[model samples]
Target: MASPTAAPALRAEHLTKHFGRTHAVEDLTLEVAAGEVFGFLGPNGAGKSTTIRVLLGLLRPTAGTAWVFDAPAADVERAHRYLAHVPADVALWPSFTGQECLDLLAGVGPGTDLVYRAELVERFGLDPGKRARAYSTGNRQKVALVAAFATRAPLLVLDEPTSGLDPLMEREFRRCIAEATGRGQTVFLSSHQLAEVEAVCTRVGILRAGRLVEVAGLAELRRLRRSEVAVELARPQPALDALAGLPGVADVRWTSPLELTLALTGPPGPVLRALGDADVVRLDVREPSLEEIFLDYYGQAAA
Candidate 1:
């Protein structure tokens, strides 16, 4: 049973996983709410996968504790009825067709209803007749996505689910997740593709060198980074390159006809005041994206 005190759908308490002297994941603690899309982000070997494995009960933590829906993750078999996983590389029986695989997994999941299976076939643009061996990496991913979405489980744990998908398919995958989330489903997403996480996740946890560096809402993370400003002036303006040195401004560039762009590390007021004499036509302020925010964190880590 789920906890009543806003306890999160998933959680890790000082979680740690070490392989002999190698610390694969260390002192990590985080949470994901019900019906929320949570992005677990990290560079390769940053312990993202290892942490996920521990959460899924695939590996026991060397130290600490983890829970899903108020139940211990080490008790996955007991909770398996409500969860589904889509790995980075989805493998299936080569001789089986896409439809066959979906049917098989749908059948294997705790329910007998095939209500969502039909929707998955259409939403993913899968050709039911195509054999698993003949599919491209993107197509294989599609098959796994179809199966996962079709399962309509309460929780989805996907690790780079769109690894080989093209932009179009990735867009479709995003739509699939959006639809699933709308129905109050919980998603635990791990990915190197920061853009996807930016587009969909409500909150993100960044892991670096086996430790949880930061975790916050996607919007909050961007706020901690910078704001992008584009100013349209009525007339030709003098070079404002020096604006880059302002307290909040990080970089400035002239982007278009009568437009000056400023990447502001803080509020836009200081940068706006710098253009006081210019006849400003319009000002557009855009927030930094998840990619930009994560990269900034990564840079800080490297430094």
Candidate 2:
């Protein structure tokens, strides 16, 4: 097991991939430190898969390069010793049983460790004798997940790894990830589940239109965006509409005779004072959701 330390497990420098005239990933640069789970998030057609393929050496980059544990992705034998990848649709031989698939994956390397094999079967609730064809998509994914996690590999790249999993299985996946990080393993998780990313990743990069739109810690990203503050006033004063034009207030809406919703972008102090002067029954302040944040970014990108 690698010591939990501050070294980059993966690094991409000015990586660009093009499919004809279309740019799939443009000048993308990022790093995943050892023992950290760096979440890659984007909407459909955002080049998440393209970037993963480049990292896994499944595709060659048009420009720049990607490194797995300081070695080029093109070196399969070297990468096999240090990194593992789990795809969205995990494929296994239908004729074989779950245990057979596990054995084959373990045979990939002489240094492979199966110490966690029995524990993972029980943990993920997988039956070893079940035929691969009989297993659900989630079960097949579990087989891949268990195989990747049971190894001593320093890096694990998972693209939509939990797509077919149910809630219970998702929880188990998260638990397994948490345990892996504790053992100093690095995980590069590409997922649409922002809540999951928010829960597990220490840092994240947002992709839009094949470009890196933003990269920041979760807390920092939240601070840069405005939250919606809804207030139910005890009295009505249409004059409060004046606050709409103030700085840091993006928009405002009147829900009823006394309820109003305001988009606040700055410190809440000034907004709170304005509400106090207007009189209110109760107030609610909520940070914008990940979806909302992305939508706002999209709007800006379009404009």
Candidate 3:
């Protein structure tokens, strides 16, 4: 359990970063509480990576400040003691075997749990005997993930951590994230995979072209959007005509003699009331996918 007054695991105050004349990240202010898994979302050129670099103290923010565990991020020695990180890609020493690389990473970071490292090695299906030169992209990624997960560090910063992983390995990664949160570790994830983020994140922060445009919980974002619905009836009931005029219903279309699809926003009460007396053989409602919710925000920003 996190104390209500606990210092944030990560914080940035009106943070901005620029390269020459181009502003990569601008006026970003955010806070992530202890033990929370936050998803950082953006497309290419959206400044997601730049923001991460500032948070890691790899790049000095052109303006504002970022802190980790209440230590200024620029002071790497003090701030880094509490975190472990795995970037989108990792290149290991050609001569070292996976085990050796893990050992080296562990040594350089805070103390790691050797026992848990062994377990993670097994869970991720990584073979430690292979030298880095023989490893594929996915294998190299595994080495980094295993090291980060096994560390007892309180914060894990992962950027596209599942890049080269197969679907099966992606499942395993999600499991690892669950365990991390269970142990009260905060996770800052930057990824392009909507499904993965939707699976493990408690909240999502969306960045659009170097700016923070929207930040909200998944359910809250969903509430602001519409749902796709398909309905099947025993017959072509006349109630369908009435539903077209009902509040929060639009795009009513007949796909077949017995089936119809429509977009519904807000409460389903009006639609349900209209269908109350009809022979509804089947009705299915699907909340918008994460990609759809994301676009809704982007669309708002663009307009």
Per-model TM against the reference:
0.83, 0.89, 0.90
Q: What tens digits encode model 2's per-residue C-alpha lDDT throughout 110-173?
A: 2356677789989889998999999999899999999888877888889999998888888988
Evaluation by TM-score, superior candidate among 1 and 2: 2
How big is the positional error of residue 112 in model 2, measured in Å on the Cα after superposition?
Answer: 5.1
Structure candidate 3, residue pairs in collision: none
lDDT per residue (tens digit) for residues 1-303 in model 3: 232237898999999998999999999999988999999998777998889999989999999999987789999988888899998778899999999999999998877989999999999999999999999999999999999999988899998899999999999999999999999999999988899999999999999888998789989888778899899999788657777888888999999989999999899988888888889999999999889988777787789
Decoy 3 TM-score against native: 0.90
Q: In order, what lDDT does every prediction score? A: 0.82, 0.84, 0.90
Q: Estimate, for each residue in 22-85, the C-alpha lDDT of model 1 and write its tens digit.
A: 9999999888888899999998889988898898888999999988776688998755666778
Q: Model 1, which residues run further than 4 Å from truth?
A: 1-7, 228-265, 269-286
**Which ranges of candidate 3 are over 4 A from the true structure?**
1-5, 236-240, 254-259, 297-303
Off by over 4 Å in 2: 3-6, 109-113, 237-242, 276-278, 299-303
On TM-score, the leading prediction is: 3
Descending-lDDT candidate ranking: 3, 2, 1
lDDT preference between candidates 2 and 3, better one: 3
19: Cα error in model 3, Å: 1.1
